[model samples]
Target chain A: MSVPFYDSGVASGLLSGILFGYVLEAAGFGSARKLTGQFSLKDWSVFKVMFTAVLVAAVGLYLLRLGGMIAGNSVYIPTLYLWAMAAGGLLIGAGFAMGGYCPGTSLVGIVSGRVDAVVFVVGMIVGTMAFAGVYEPIQGFYFAAKGPDAQRLPDLLGLPEWLILAVLIVVAIAGFVLGSRLERARGGPFTAEDVNGEDTSKAKNQNTTFNTEAGIVP
Target chain B: MTSSPRPFWPPLVAGAALGIALLISFLITGHGLGASGFVTRLSAQISGWLAPDLTTANAYFGPFLTAGAPLASWITWEVIGVLIGGYVGARTAGRSRLMVERGPQASVGQRFAFAFIGGALVGIGGRLARGCTSGLGLSGGATLAVAGFVFLAGFFIAGFVVSALVRRAWQ
Candidate 1:
């Protein structure tokens, strides 16, 4: 077959989603503890996983393009909607921290039997409906910045595309280093005792030593 | 816990593999990657089913309805892939368990509330941002889109700030 494979929409997405979910779970993204730990600066698997994936793809795709293999850019490059994106970023970030799963990861969680992840999916759906429902009122501002221009860092800042990409690569590497330092400083990854998946505050209240020997500290 | 909680793959290994997934995604569909778009359309479909007029009347949902049906999308299939793949991953790793993830200091109900609200926020944010982490951060960032960076900055800023207050959720 060709370098660019056939794109049967549903078939494509289904296979892609399966791969996506599998990779996520393998990376430990299915666990809220590992994911949420990023925010607390306790464990950095989240940063590590995200940064590594992004960097690898960014560099790989660029290389493929240079070789004239992959052809043009992705099917869709999200346009710049500054106000809307900024607002969305805040809510999404907060949700990720609080809910402990982004949309992709949440699906992974659901399959892994995490009830909270399922709940989150439900909440996100309701929230989406709410947004769609209220779109009538917010349309003016919601799409105020919407346009056809595809904004790239090079074009926006007048920098060479290669230079920007190089910088991003450098930044991702630096982030990995920082992630390692933060992980260590946080006194190693949280054991089951620290986040036993239930209210173990009672045990903490007793100030008793956590007996991991039995494997059921509570 | 059995086997002291099986360890997950190192980030470098798993992430690079994931990047390959992105590469395949591009090769197959010419699209980078995304998840929230599926949920958004699904939500609209539901809304359309119950209140077709109102859904079609709203500028946001209306435009989407014009494009045939929201039920059919590349995102839906990919998300299905995510579900099956996740099951495989969790099953192989021995990490599949039905439970609500929260800190020892919190309760199930508290976690549920937090989950719902946080999910709602992501729902709102996903639409505004035009994509979620995988969509914006991974796919968009890989493409070097300027808005991708902006969304990334905002997401991390909000996440860091909120994480401080909600430390009990994971700490």
Candidate 2:
């Protein structure tokens, strides 16, 4: 396929990035407290946002391809380097749990003026260089960490991708239901404003709100 | 006499917005979303800048030298937009507080220290795994990639484990 505008990905990427950032910030993902809420199960916002996005994209893309709206990228399914992916994900999760941001989300935090997010980004950059420098020393485990295949699970299982997507959507909806009930049980009777952590008056009115100064309604 | 701005959107709603953005991305370009690749490219460029011969000669940086302008990637630009968009989103939501996000128990210096270490882990992990949350979790996951689920499973399991150890960071 002919590349779109050859090298003007600047425009495409910039506009998309802008939208991506705007939505992330709107979700309150820029806040570490809000994000970490998932780890503690204090707030299900992170899980809610993430799974919802996954469901939408998975279902939407599958349908789009079916309808032939988007022919789709050739390597739609990423290669499953099982061990590397597992190890890397674990480490990144540790980072996310501790730093409260991923590379993409950290950008949102930095733009929103979180000092720690900035520090995290800096550290990631340095770490990338360090990893590159050490790449040669550990090629065996890193390079050879392959999964059974690089295709989507549906492809491997001989089912339609949309079917799995449907299954995922069902699971996500169930999760959403469970998350809501849990939230109510954890902190009863929260208004939209309190959940958003935007009401200054509410914070002022209550000495011991559910949330701390960071906005994870304690 | 004004309505309160929602501190954030409903996750479903916000996720819908994200879904649409991702759809547009696939429509226009045959790519999903990513963030760590930009950092890798930037690192290569920096290495090139610092030691022109090193970038040209090193194993990791050498391939980048042949791959045209690494700095002008879509992901790099997207991240730049992330910064701008994040600022706008935070301000719009009335949640743009410029401070370190740490638990009451953790000090500023300690929080920043952890932030750096955690970030470094992410960097190495992204490289080792060839993607990050946005890249692997969302982009690849959306495609029903098996690796996506693996990353997801690994991410949560390890995240929970580590959180147990460093519970003080964000108590």
Candidate 3:
């Protein structure tokens, strides 16, 4: 239950943030071209990485809870505001696809020295300020359709936690299989160089088999 | 100085590592990872400084001001760490570069415009949803929270639709 080293909230925040950011960058999520590849179906890294992480954390949390290492109420669960969450998701998804960066990934993009990412961050700040500016008029919509505090899927479905976890694992595995096939069909399994948009001109001049059309250079 | 970037880690590997990070976060902080909250707080702080009275009187920015110094929050420190960690990761992988990444057909101006517009939308949406990808999707999803799953579904569906419409920006 106690992690002596990171017991302090600040310590935990810094440590986890670093680890999270590092992994994201290493997975090539920092690259706009790469992250957006999901939309084009040219790459499945985003989906694969996201689902894998979700599964690992989900299973791990369940086990930890079962073992009583973490009290049930200790872990924070975001309150459900059905309307707000749905509307927010649509807006965020549109932004993500258009901008090719989420908040976390945008930070990663900034550190990777992408100028567009800097602009994106500025936009986020401005947007957030805009939200605050318009908060009063939209306040009702923001809090509409509120659900039970800390509503969980298992509770809603009236299913056991383990069963839900099992179903998710199966679903994730199925997705991975399908994703890999799609990638192969699309001449994918793209490298960092391909997705990062590395100097393709030089690569092309070198007579390497760079499929510009497919955006995959093997 | 111009070394080629390293290939990324296999997706599953990176995801598992990230998941472990998330797990450790729960064990330590009793919560999940986040990023937008830091931005929210930063915006609130800046707004407070610019218009203390108006900011404090607002419903959204008011609570942030009353909470204490925004920069002193936990999410703020975590975001700072994210910057450092991302830089380190990019440097080690030879992926750090100062350039505007965009589709070959897209101009630098176009990329910048989209980036800004997209970012602004994310900011508004993140606030409305009370979290972003990391906060709601990764953290809350792991906990089986209905909000997390709902956000994820909406995000992907909308993302794909928008991406298809704006395919030229990327493809």
Candidate closest to the true structure, highest DockQ: 3
Chain A TM-score across all models, in listed order: 0.82, 0.80, 0.89
Residue pairs whose backbone atoms clash in candidate 2: A210-A217, A210-A218, A211-A217, A211-A218
Which consecutive 10 residues in model 1 chain A have the weakest lDDT in total? A191-200
Model 2 CAPRI rating: medium
What CAPRI-style quality would you assign to candidate 3? Answer: medium
Better of 2 and 3 by DockQ: 3
RMSD of each: 4.1, 4.0, 2.6
* Candidate 1 lDDT (Cα, 0 to 1): 0.80
Give me the runs in candidate 2 sitting further than 4 Å from their true place.
Answer: A1-8, A72-75, A148-150, A188-218, B1-5, B66-68
lDDT scores for all predictions? Answer: 0.80, 0.78, 0.88
| Candidate 2 structure quality by residue, lDDT tens digits, A87-186 | 8899899988888888888888887778998899888988898888888887787867576655788767898776777788888889889888877676
User: Each predicted complex: what DockQ?
Assistant: 0.67, 0.64, 0.76
Model 1 reproduced share of reference interface contacts: 0.85
Question: Tens digit of lDDT per residue, candidate 2, span B13-39?
Answer: 988888888766665556677889888
Comparing 1 and 2 on lDDT, the stronger one:
1
How does model 1 score by TM-score?
A: 0.89
State how far residue B33 of model 1 sits from its true place (Å).
1.4
Write one digit per residue (lDDT tens) for candidate 3, span B99-136. 89898899999999999999999999999999999999
* CA displacement after TM-score superposition, residue B157 of candidate 1 (Å): 0.2
